[model samples]
Target: MAAALAVTGCTSQSSGPSKVSSSSGGPAPGDSRTPPHSAPPRSPSTSAATSGKTPGGGSASGAGRTPSSRPPGQGAGFPHCSPGTLSASLRQLEAAAGNRYAALVLTNTSDRPCRTQGWPGLQLTSEGGGRIPTETARDRAHEAQPITLKPDDRAWSRLHWTVVSSSGDAADGSCPTPGALRIIPPDERHSLGTGWDLGTVCGKGRIQATALSTGEGPAH
Candidate 1:
């Protein structure tokens, strides 16, 4: 079973939408990659402090995997963690009509070296039916917000959730239904201004959803 992290003394980690965030003060003189919203402890000359960014997002093909043999960063050994440590977070949870959407806040909390990753994909459950991947708007957007977490650093971004609607634009005001989890990956990205439908299923208690993979394969 996956365990929750509760150790002390270490920097408390968190995840949210990482599309936008002003970097913390104290940027290196030569590194402009560090966005204004990057994590803190910003030094004047520390190459390691600058947040690294990857190429375009990775490909995610989730639908064919044996339970006993999951992919890396998954399965029984998974931390089963919350938004913390994760690169993004759901800053705001909103409800319009009968639909629900989450305003995500993505941030980096480590100091050594790490890069931003993935669009916030969703595996949502339909109202009187089954689940499906929420519409994804990962590609339509850009990751100009650089987040480099020093020993004690932070950065943030706010993003909206994709819903089960085909007539509304994500920026125009479309929300997702209840039960969804944002997808995070290092090597995959969604189509520009488009969304994928995973047919997610809703469960009891907190909203039900899972993160999408960052490669071209079947679900686990």
Candidate 2:
């Protein structure tokens, strides 16, 4: 009878330890089962890698995408007008005093709309494409404003120059005639060429220009 009691006591002690260990609610060192509510925290890198996304909310694949080259205030729908997409023309105005005047017209030849602003670069060239002496001065009396142009639409800039020679010009008041005029749009390196039929600009090839405006310039 004592032997049986000893066996029972040993079994109860061993079983109690097993029950206490199981109720501890912790994973054993070599236990294959994960403890309840003890999931590993997700790391940012792991999450990003799994979702194929960057921390900036952009796709990982788009991280290397090129940015838009359009200038500020210019919408994606209408880019700034480039010289290659424009055609240049000239309108001779009535001569006044010793100064001659004309309007430089720029027409959008592209199918899409474009924007333009500020003064355009002007140059005079010979018939053989040789560069001629030219000087352009901007008239800031009128402020420059962005002008949007649709296909076939136009923008104009006023040009004024003296036909009479200044002290800085030749002694005979004679000036070289330009066969072609090169018009470069603002912020562009390319130019559009147009014929120059107006007579000589006598003030050392100097001409005054205004910022581009909407529609055609003054008629007279």
Candidate 3:
């Protein structure tokens, strides 16, 4: 009886160890099968560079780049010539029918082309920087024409005034002599002029102006 009991006990102990070993080798309940691998987030600049884009939203074909300047008459959108971009001068062209005639010439000094249009705003000023009141006489027969001037090219307008009276005459009276002419380009508020000696007249419309043209005009 004692021998039979020992064999049973040995069988049970061997079976118990095998079962424990098998259970230990496997994953436990509620345990994950493998650890997950996470990646880092990418930055916006890095993403844009890889996609052939600039941080400023520019593309590979130069889109969003600074636009080059355009010439006049290519479109109405072309900018007009500001006084800063021009050099101006006046020359008496002739005297006709008891009136003095002169050409106000403007030369484009910029590298780009510019438009000269409409009538130039005109005024007379003293050498002391005081505004001289004068009347503007528009040439009714003259037309407002737009002219395009390329670099170093020129445009001109005509001005006519009555001969200065010496008597300070009461009927065609005399006024303060002007030291300069104030010229404002068409559609602009800025002015340009140099020393001028247009003797003053008492009446309105003493001086008349024509619109800008390709050359000096009696035919604007």
Give per-model TM-scores.
0.31, 0.65, 0.58
Model 3, runs deviating above 4 Å: 1-74, 164-172, 198-202, 216-220
Give the higher-lDDT candidate: 2 or 3.
2
Error of 3 at 189 (Å): 1.0
Ranking by TM-score: 2, 3, 1
Candidate 1 local lDDT, 57-92, one digit each (tens): 222222221112132322222222124444544444
- Candidate 3 lDDT over 44-115, as tens digits, reads 876665665222232212211122222323324335677778777878775766577788887777776555
Model 3 CA lDDT for position 32 = 13
lDDT of 3 at 145: 55
lDDT of 2 at 26: 21
Candidate 1: lDDT over CA atoms?
A: 0.30
TM-score of 2: 0.65
Candidate achieving higher TM-score, 1 or 3 = 3
